[model samples]
Target chain A: MIVCIKQVPDTTDVKIDPEKGTLIREGVPSIVNPFDKNAVEAALKIREEKGGKVTVITMGPPQAVDALRECLAMGADDAILLSDRAFASSDTWATSYTLAMGIKKVGNPDIIFCGKQAIDGDTAQVGPGIAEHLGLPQVTYVQKIKEVKEDGMIVERSIEGGYEVVSVGMPVMIAVDKSINEPRFPTMMGTMKAHKKEIPTWGLAELGADEDKLGMNGSPTRVKRIFAPERKGQGEMIQGDDESEVCALLIEKLRDKKVV
Target chain B: MAVKIIAEECIGCESCIDACPFPGAIVMDDGIAKLTDKCNGCGACADACAVEAILVEETEVKSGIDINDYKGVWVFIEQRDNHIANVSLELICEGRKLANELGTELAGVVLGDGVEELTKYCFAYGADKAYLVDGPVFKDYRTDSYTDVIVEMINRYKPEVVLFGATNNGRDFAARIAVRVHAGLTADCTELGIDPETKQLMQTRPAFGGNIMATIICPNHRPQMATVRPKVMKKVEPDFTKTGEIIRVENSVKEEDVTTKILEIIEHATKMINLSEAEIIVSGGRGIGGPENYYLIENLAEVLGGAAGASRAAVDAGWVPHYRQVGQTGKTVAPKLYVACGISGAIQHLAGMQTSDVIVAINKDPEAPIFKVATFGIVGDIHKVVPLLTKKFKELKEAN
Candidate 1:
């Protein structure tokens, strides 16, 4: 089993670097994207049941080593970090292409798992994109795994009105939703051993990835512009000592707005 | 830069004539669409020419992927147990405009068991044609089977554009189909449009946690795909007198071909979720304090006959079920009246309910972000405020 994860800015602690006109990462904390952590949890469960090694991978800067170590503490057996200056600013398509090459180098596993989307990119394309690059069947938004048999697995997929159970053959890719399972806490022994476990960092040349498809050069989508959405204007505020007075004022205002 | 037309290859379909935004760009002379001075090398005509008779010289800007082989626009009409979803109808309505712009046919793809009868609504909503795949294997949307059906149709027909409602099923298979067909997919988009010059699908979605909006385009891939957020677009009024062609799609995918099976389906009671379509909504958050106080929010909704909603914090704290959560992670509602109590207006939460016609916020924090978007605000605790508001509304109702 192989799990893919990314290190993301903790949304709660993010601050913008006004001078640079970008998000400030100097002091802000980072964590494994919540969805990817869930993916790690799903991978750990499958490893426990099926008796296999869970190898995790990530593509990011050198500092992303912290993320790989954390996954090791969470029970992932091995971790790989694909760090290269060339990989910066890659959109989902290019990012997935680079990840697919890394997977090929690692040798194809029976199953691959990824979170539905990353909090930072919020573009759930890479998981599916990898499936396309690797030529494998995929299922997205999986809520639960019903059964894992000899050659395939049955899983429940959440839809609009109800859940549908679907089966797919092995050597498959899955993007799991949040409702799948609750993530486990890293054990004391695991945390103590995580640092001792050596993690490997791979670069573009080592992965034998084409330079054209590894970075901004290969990305098709472009951000023409970006700006914060303007906050709404001021509204009539009612503040008073008595809650009843405020409620009465609110009712009158709702009437004025023709809402009542 | 100039567009040249081949006389012998011209079919005189005149699709390029409609696709040209500039009046004199392409003119029909002797049954051939020819480029005039008005042609600025925008290249929209070349894409619209189904026969490939027109070409623009020295202005060839190729997308990363070849899009020349694709044609038509498709909407996936999502259905559950034979009941068609309203969002699917809205997509057909929206797809018609895009198709007509590109000089192509607009079609709806419907797949399910016993759903052939519901295909009529596709035409009522302006679909020029529809594809129906009916079988016991498609009784429920299995990701593998449904994906196979749609992927087969897309590969065979080669649609230039495909749209799906950002519902769970749509979100699930859309990503899969995008992968299998090697198409580019933009998810949970708030807006959809066509680039007049490039003829590429322009998909705009909220990014950076709803703090900024990003417009994305899959310029290189054929069959550009998007899953637009439900309720963001208005449904077109159905014309019952309208009719169109229904092509029965033959599918060989069988039960054995799929690996997943539904032992049972536990449906979340949907009567409350008509929350997205509700005209009025009264919602509560963590500030009301605990699950026990939730009735205060429910009481206000009941008195007004509106739906009850909750912020993610309230839902996460076990104060309410996830179905009632109103935020980026939950449901997006645009009611005529939205009364929010105790929420401080996280940007993700605001994105869900900000489109309501009337927004009223009640929170102890007077400076909460929710107040900025609110038409009216009250600085008071929800425990006291909600009950008073509910009582006052009841008295007013009795008087009326």
Candidate 2:
């Protein structure tokens, strides 16, 4: 089993500096993307039951080794960081292409796992993109693995109002949802071993990827601008002497809006 | 890929550090601004540079596709159980406006077994043309089969802009097609526009959990693809009198070629808690105190004839099921009336339901961010205020 992960700036860590009119970047901790952690947990569970080695891979900067180390501490057999200056500024298309190359270099596996989406980008495109590049069937938004078989497995994929049970063959890609499992904290022994582990860093040359399809040059989308969203105007506070009066006033207001 | 910072002009003011969205993307190395690998070339740091020390090289790479060949604005018409999904209709309504703005035709791309008759509904909604791919293999929504058909259709008759409903199935197949066709795809766009000068599709979406809004454009790609969540766009009233040109296409994908099989679909057995379709929603949060007190929320929702919802805190605490969660990680809802009880309105929570027509926040703390977006706010305990509101509404219904 191979699990894909990403390191992201914790969304809760993002804050705007009122005085500077800029993001307060200091003291913001970068953690493994929560959804990716869920994916790693799912992969670890499958390995525990199926008795196979789990390999974790990520394509990010050199600092992304920290994220892989954290995954290693969670009991992944091996960790690989595909880091290079050439892989910078990649959109989902290029990111997925690079990750797919890394996956091929790592060797064949019966199953591949990925998080539903990265919190930082929130595009949810990489999982499907990798599946397409590799020409593999994908079951996305998987909430649970109902039953595992030798050649195939039954998984519950989350849909609009509910979930659909799907039977898929091996060598398939599964993108997991947050509802799948509660990720475990790293044990002290595992943490020490993870610190001692030397994760291999693969670059574009190692992956044997085309330079024209590697980074910003290969990305189709471009950011025109990013700004703080305009704040909603101050809302009207319903004033009443008592809760009953407030409720009556609110009901009247709803009626005026034709909402009641 | 590199967002270069010219060290010769470095004033080391650290303005770029503050402006950079990614932490540790830019750092000061010996009183000179330096670029780290964390930079995704967003260019915010360059804009913030006072000394003009930062440079972002924007090299346009052509994907060998003629952009001029793509013309119409198309919405992928999604259906289940032989009924067209409301979100597809909503996109057709939106696509109509975009098509008008672009001076192009609006079309609907439908794929299903015997879904030929559904073209009339698409035409009624707003599409001027319908591309129908009918077959048994196209009945169920499978990633492989759907991507194979749609990618071929897109390559044959190029649409300048393709909009999907952002449903689970929508996101799944759309991503694959976008990658295969080498088109730029944006997810969960709240607003879309055409650049007046360049004629490019401008896609704006919330990032960092609604803390930032980024406008993206695919200048070099042929088809600009986007996925809009349900309830985010309005649908025009149907005009059954309208008719469209139906172009039937063949689906060559065989059942044996598809790798995954849908064994069963199990809808939640409980009362349908579809908050996106609900007119009103009453939600509780950390301030609701405990799981036992959740009945107040349900009672308020019942009295108002609405669905019950919960904040991430409440849902994370296991007080309520995940389906009833209303927030970024949960569901984005734009109801007529959203009553947030004790939900202090974290930015993530507000990102989901702040678009409601009427927002009522009931919390003991007056300074909660929920009040900022509320149409009516009560600075009182949910334990006391929720029941009173429920009682008052019950009495009003009885009197009526």
Candidate 3:
């Protein structure tokens, strides 16, 4: 099993001035998304139970190796980083295509696991887009993994009302929700092993990825602009001593507006 | 330009061929609807087809609406058991502001059985007009019945922007209506604005997991549709002196067409801590120590006359059930007063409760992120602070 993770600049760390919509990322630190940790944990648990190697993969700049190393320290057997200058500014479609190519390069695994969505981009399209690109069955928003059989797996999916149990054939893609599993903290032994282990880095050429289908050029959706929402009028706080008085006060205000 | 047909694994269903309202557009080929040039792309055929075998390509054509052409901004007034949901009233307040900005009127669409009395209340709140759809079929919310009535009114009146609360019933009804009318619908909007340049409704909402907000626009669609979350907006006061025109809408829905039967309506017993509807909420985190200490937090919440909540970490630790968890993975709450006891306030947790009117934090760690948004910060043991606050509240209540 191979799980792909991304390192995003901690949104809290990035200072944004409300008056001026600009991000100050100079001193901001990046971390593996907290949600993706659940995906890594799910993969490691499956590898332990099914006797398979869990390889972690990421596509980012050189600094992204830090994220892969963290995954290795969490008990992943191997880590791979897909980094190249050509892969910058890729949207959800391009990102999924690139990751799909990277997965193919690492020996077509039986299953792939990913976080439901990345925090920074907040587009839940990547996982579903990958499933569409690979022509594989997808089970999204999976809250629980009931069982993993030889041919398929059963999962509890979170829907609008409650939950639905679904069975999907293997060689499937899954976008795991945060409630799927609890990620374990890296131990001293794992950390030491991770320190000695080197993550193999791959580029577009190494993965045999199509240049046109690898980055912004391949993405269909383009964001024209990003701006903060216009604030509404100054709100009037209703005040009174009792519920009836408050209700009366509200009624008075509404009478003025002709709204009963 | 040629229209593209994206076939989604058709099972040779002839429903589309029989249901295409347009003449000669669809023909039966291999027991499936094969498209021809006569297809007008009106999508009535798609709606009638049970198999979902038809797809229509929409072109991005800009339609200009004269600023003075539209008269009023209306909100769908949703009610349960004859009483208005807080969200509907909240949207009316919001719609009033938008109507004022556009120099127009604000109206509320009230559809129910014997809800004529609610029309006066709508005018008292902020509505300049109340469109009432009263009938027995419209008594309980059924998807097809409500959609048909609402769509009929929208087609006749042609309001500029329509808003719905993002509740289960609201979303279901709104999605069906939007699909029926071939209009763009933005769901779970947190913010709404009018573009000064284009007069377009800018609908903003948390896209992923409250990680980033995206603003959407429907330039070509008539009567722009948006579904706002409950508690994200304020409800205005009702004024009896204010008056509006009460327009009675006759419903044409027959009892037989409604296939779903309501066997029995059994409402669940009210929860002790209804966090979603609470005006004030006091939540505990993992730092509360264990499940046993949750009682201290609950006691404080009771004294404050508020509901108790828990962080995802505490909930996952078996300290509380998942419903009480407040974060991206759990429920989003915005209350008048939010007290965080021992919460570290991760970004995900903040996403849920950052919109509270007033936040008070009590954590042992002085550097905890919860303090950043806390109006009152106490760096001490929650066990100590909670008990002290509970006792103080009791004394204050007794003195009063």
Candidate 4:
């Protein structure tokens, strides 16, 4: 089993660098994407039950090694970091292509997993894009996996209306949501084990990915503009002498607005 | 320049037929592709034309892309159990305006079994034409089947732009088709407009943790795709008397060919909460305190004849169920009246309910972000104020 992860800037109160039209990452704390943590837990759970090696991979800058080390502490047996300057500025399309080629280099696996969407891009395209690239079946927004049979697995996929239980064949790729499982905290012993383990690193040449499909030059989509949206006009603030008076006034207003 | 399909080099792979999005552009003759008059020289078939058989005249090419070749704006009309999605109608309203602004036709593309009868609603709403692809393969929303058909349809009759509601199914399968067709798709957009100067679609959506809104444009892609959030766009009034043309497109994907199977649909929540359709909602936050105090919210909702809503904080804390959670990760509700009690209003929570027609916020802290969008705000203790407000509303209702 292989789980793909990404390291994203913690965006609770992130600010944009208006001049460069980019996120101000200078002092912003970075963490493994919340959704990717859920996926890592899912992959580890599958390995625990199904009895297989869990190999996690991520494609990002050299600093992404920290994210892989965290996954290692989470019980993943191995970590592969695909880092290269040539891969910078890749969109979801190029990212998926590069990840697919990188995964293929590690050898074919029974299953692949990734977060439903990344916080920075919020595109949720890479998992399905990789599936298309590798010709594997896919399921997204998975809430629960009921069972993993020898040939196929049954999963409850979350939809807007409800959830549908789907049985997809093995060799399928799934993008998991937070509802799938709660990620566990790393223990000190686990941290020590991860620190002692060697993490392998690969690049475009090692993955043998086509150069045209690795970065901005290969990305089909481009960011035309990025800025803060203008705030709307202010709304009214009504106060009253007392609670009943306020409720009465609010009721009158609701009646005027045809709301109650 | 016109597209030429060389019959001899064509290996009868049907790749061209599947790749062409324009209807009537290519047809299978003796298992070989035959180009028809409907071909607009978009040359989408070039990559999939396998054998390098399909050729286009080079004189009119601009950077190897013919932008003028594609025309029309399309709205994906998603339906389930014979009910057309309201988001589809909303998208139709938006798509109709874009099509007019672009001087092109607006069509609603419906894909499902026995859904042909619902195509008239597309016209009643605003679509100039309806593209109906009917079959049992669409009985269930399978990623592989839907992606195959939609991608093939885009390749056949290349619509300049396609709009999909950012519902679960829409968000699920849209990227797959976009990736397959190599088109650009914007996700969960809150606003859609046309860039008058460049003749491009301006797709705006709240991003970066909903702190800022970014307007994305697909400058070079032929068919620009965007998935709009539900209830964000205006729902046009239906014109019952109006009728439109219905064109049936063929999709050869089979059920047995798909690798996924639906064992059953497990609807854990028996009753569906139509928060989007609710006129009034009384939502509580973590400050509402515990599960015991939930009855205060329920009583208030009962007095006002409104549904109960909760903040993600409260839901995560298990004060109320997740279905009632109104936030970015939860449902987006645009009720006529949204009363926020004790909700300190994180941006994620505000993104879901800020669009309400009238927002009344009651918080102990005056600096709560929810007050920014509220029509009325009361800074006070909810424990004392909620019970008093419930009693007053009950009295007012008795008098009315």
Best-performing candidate as measured by TM-score = 2
Top of the candidates by DockQ: 2
Candidate 4 lDDT at A109 equals 82
Q: What would the per-residue lDDT of candidate 1 be over residues B62-159, giving only the tens digit for each residue?
A: 44555788999999988877888777887888898889888889999989888877778998889988899998999877667888788888878889
lDDT tens per residue, model 2, A1-260: 88999998887767877655456657779999988888899988988888998999999888899999999999899999999989877888899999989999998877889998887777899999988888888999999999888888899998877789999988889999888898988999989999999999999888899998888877898887777777667888887898778878888887888887
Candidate 2 residue lDDT tens string, B150-260: 888888899999999888888998899999999999998888888999999999998877777898989889799999877778888899999989998866788999889
The list of candidate 4 runs beyond 4 A from truth reads A15-25, B1-65, B268-280, B298-307, B332-334, B387-400
| Prediction 2: B-chain TM-score | 0.87
TM-score of each: 0.81, 0.93, 0.57, 0.85
- Residues B133-180 of candidate 4 have per-residue lDDT tens digits of 889888778889988888888888989999988877787777777777
Q: lDDT at B38 for candidate 3?
A: 56
What is the lDDT, from 0 to 100, of the residue B166 in candidate 3? 70
Name the candidate, 2 or 4, with the larger DockQ value: 2
RMSD of each: 10.7, 2.8, 16.7, 13.0
Clashing pairs in 1: A166-B260, A167-B259, A167-B260, B65-B220
Expressed as tens digits, the lDDT of each residue in A67-155 for candidate 1 is 98899999999999998988876777678888888888888788899997887656677887887678777777787988777788888
Off by over 4 Å in 3: A1-260, B1-71, B140-144, B195-197, B204-216, B252-272
Q: Evaluate model 4 with DockQ and give the value.
A: 0.28
- Which TM-score value belongs to model 2? 0.93
lDDT of 2 at A36: 86
